[model samples]
Every structure is written in C-alpha cells, then in structure tokens.
Target: MIFVSLYLFMFCKMEENSGHISVADFSKHLFWDVNKSEIDLMRDRHYVVRRVFSCGLMNDWNLICRLYGIQEIGEIAKQIRDLDPKSHAFIALIAKIPEEDFLCYTTKQSTPQHWNF
Candidate 1:
C-alpha cells in the first residue's frame, strides 16, 4: 500500500512537471510546430489543454479530463480532423495562431510580429 501510494505521488508530480515543460522540450519530443510560447505551456495544464482543444484536438472527454483537467481535447481533435478542407481552414483560422505567426516561429524568424486582430 505504501509503495502504491508513493508511486502514485511520483506519477502525479511527473505529470505536473510535464505540463510545466518548456515549448522547446515539447517541440523536441513531438517534432511539430506547437505555435505557442513557452510561457503559455508553463502557465497551467488546463491552459495547454484549452489551447490544444481550441485547435480541435480534444476528442476523448474522459481522457482529457484525466490528463489535463479538461474534458474536450479528444473531441475537438476529432472534429477538426473530420472537417472538410476549406471548412477546416476556416476553423483553423478561428482557433489557431495566424499562419504568419506559426510560420515565423517555425522558420526561426526574429522580431516577428503576431497578428493584431
């Protein structure tokens, strides 16, 4: 029982720190443009979950709630994936960072200005 409790505690701490992990670390692990600042992820797991959800990436509510204290990342991801191409583009525009911003960061462009509106 004690060992089980200890393992659970460690697991929770690991997840907490994982959510606090830097964008660079996450990018290195995933090999994709997260398109958000490091500070954003460090804020809170819920924030990151919401960001991912906004991108239409959350579909499994139970998993999302368990993983990120939210309940929609899996559903959103599925919805985005199911969208028609043009409609997906529109949805992406509504939820994601502007293409220019994502491009600027991906290309390592310095002093890049994000969209004002």
Candidate 2:
C-alpha cells in the first residue's frame, strides 16, 4: 500500500512539473483525426484545452488541471466557442467564474434557445 501511494505521489509530481503533454497520454479517440506526435501542448493550447474539456475523461481533466490549473483552463475555456454546455458549467462553477465570462455561454445567449419554445 505504501509503495502504491508513493508511486502515485511521484507520478503526480512529474505531471505537475512536466511542461509537455503528448496526445498519446490522452484517450485514443480524443485525437483520432490528428497526428498524435505532432501536437505540442503549449503551441496547441487552444486545441488541447478545447478537446479535453469537451470530450476528455476525468483523468484527462485532472492531468490538465495539474498541468495548467483551473485558472488557466478557465481562461482558455473563455475563448472556446464549441465547448459543451455541461463542461462550461463545470468549469465556471469550479473556477468560481460567472457563466457570462465564457464565450460559449455568451454566444449561446445571443442565439435563440430552441428549448425555450
């Protein structure tokens, strides 16, 4: 039990300190349409942040949170127009930011709600 705990601690520290995250670290389907090796985490922060929020699992979320933290992710989320509704709400609540701060939320408001009728 101690060994597993120690290993987990070390793994989390490595992820936190490492500035790079590869596509392969995520689920296979997350980047199916792109060359996994070519995607640079820092250069493609917008893309990675969007896909991770929209389609990534809990592990993926945790990884990004560790790498970028809730504040950075929330800032990235602000510019992502296609972020899912649930994901948007989750981030807003977690980041303690209002829904109006998110581009997705504001854009959504600009359009007529189909569900309203």
- Predicted model with the maximum TM-score: 2
lDDT by residue for model 2 (14-105), tens = 66646666667787878889988898877887888888876788678767767776678889998988667877777787666899988887
What's the C-alpha lDDT at position 101 in model 2? 85
lDDT of 2 at 48: 85
Q: Lowest summed lDDT over 10 consecutive residues: which window, candidate 1?
A: 56-65
- Residue 66 displacement in candidate 2 (angstroms): 1.5
RMSD to truth, every model: 15.0, 6.7
Candidate 1 segments exceeding 4 Å error:
1-19, 29-70, 82-117
lDDT of 2 at 58: 65
TM-score, candidate number 1: 0.24
Note the Cα lDDT for every prediction shown.
0.37, 0.74
**Relative to the unseen true structure, what is the C-alpha lDDT of residue 3 in candidate 1, on a scale of 0 to 100?**
69
